[model samples]
Target: MFDRFKERTPVRDSLTFLEPNPMRILILLFITIATYAFAKEKMFGNGSLPAFLKHFDTNSDDLIDEEERQAIRDLRAKLREKRRTSIDLDQDGEISENEVSMARAALREQIEQRRLQKFSSIAGEDDLISREEYTTIPGVRNLPDFIFDAVWRRLDTDESGYISPEEFLSRLLKH
Candidate 1:
């Protein structure tokens, strides 16, 4: 038995037999990366026109009429005033460079704190925001579910059926 075992030749060369096909491995990697890149582009590319129109077209018309345009202008004015008030740290009418810097820091901190608070309230014990839970957000509650579903999809980048704190905060902060 021992003699027979010793006499047997090696089953091919170890290096050749164990080596993976480099071309196949490279092709697989390329395909995976290309698929991921294409998906990301499709999800985030210039597909926001529908959402924009839905938000501004208050009368449910596809086109934004003069009245709708004026509403948008008014909203913008209100937002500008709010931002100006926040930036003016000293409660003065004018914003100085120092005040701007201070306001920037303060705003960042406040935003972070508020985001965490909101996420905590929305996510609750599960620590994940489902579609229903997402809709419950203050400003979001007013929007129709169909309209906001697009926004939810974009925010849920992983497509995991729920929004994590990181995803919620990062996406909201971007806008």
Candidate 2:
């Protein structure tokens, strides 16, 4: 058995061109990185200021009007307020560093509890939900198949063919 292994080493070494060439590996790495960059650019919508200006410049006059500029400022303020609200879980208008994680966890827990309640209502006495059971649930059955499938699969995090109450609750809780 040892001799068989030893013989294969020489055979592998003799095939010099078949060996993984560093230059080829480097080229493949470069291609993979380039592909990733390209994909990310396409997948994430452009957020560049010029793109934003183009989008909001409705009149096509090559310049934004005072009203348009005000709209932009309002949009920026709204976004800022949204960020503050998200980080300030208690709605206290401020977010201290210590409260950051606690706030996040609190928000996630609240959302999870709501999801669990919904799942429990549909799960009946089984305490576990399969995809079919989920699709056939009265409130959910009305949803189109594609939409329901996507939501169900997302909740079935472990992909173990069922969604436990815990799994349903934590599916998108983020913590």
Candidate 3:
């Protein structure tokens, strides 16, 4: 219509405003946030057994042998002694994947509680996962917090919240 009217050309949209794709903008924002979070996250807890075998148990092995188990047991003893010394950094005694996870979870809980306690009243998942919760797990009958702590620590090697493939090898093979 403007062309037919012989009017002077108007500026194109880009020439007037810096409008970008809204969806793309949102996706970029989300990716930025996710990358930051991933970076901030403690990169450990590779508890998957398959991944462990992939790295240590050479020859594409699927099972752990006695010798392999002994090596793991030795590693655990070393790490335990190291924890007793200064390597643990946290000084809680004992070193394993789960112990690290629990400590971090506990820290996060404490930080959140401190922030929220000023206004609200509720507990985190850890606080809710009480002694009874541990006992409720099949084969973990009547286990106390100390036992749970030990088990959790052993499973958590890389120190991320969840256990990993290597952690399974370390804990089960060592035992």
Model 3 TM: 0.23
lDDT for predicted candidate 3 compared with the true structure: 0.55
> In candidate 1, which residue pairs clash?
none
RMSD of each: 21.4, 15.8, 25.1
Cα lDDT for residue 159, candidate 2? 84
**Higher-ranked by TM-score: 2 or 3:** 2
| lDDT tens per residue, model 1, 1-175 | 5786545366544445456887568767977886676665447665433454478887775677899889977997898799889888788799999988998889899989998898999899999999889878788988877779889888898999999989988898888
Q: Kindly list the per-residue Cα lDDT of model 3 for residues 61-152, writing each as its tens digit.
A: 55577777777678868975764454345566656676667667777677655644421222234332333443455776756768877886
Provide the lowest-lDDT 10-residue window in model 1: 44-53
State how far residue 55 of model 2 sits from its true place (Å). Answer: 16
Going through the candidates in the order shown, the clash numbers are 0, 0, 13
Could you give the candidate ranking by lDDT, starting with the highest? 1, 2, 3
> Which segments of candidate 2 are over 4 A away from where they belong?
1-69, 82-95, 124-127, 136-162, 170-175
Q: TM-score for every candidate vs. truth?
A: 0.41, 0.35, 0.23
Candidate 2 TM-score over all chains jointly: 0.35
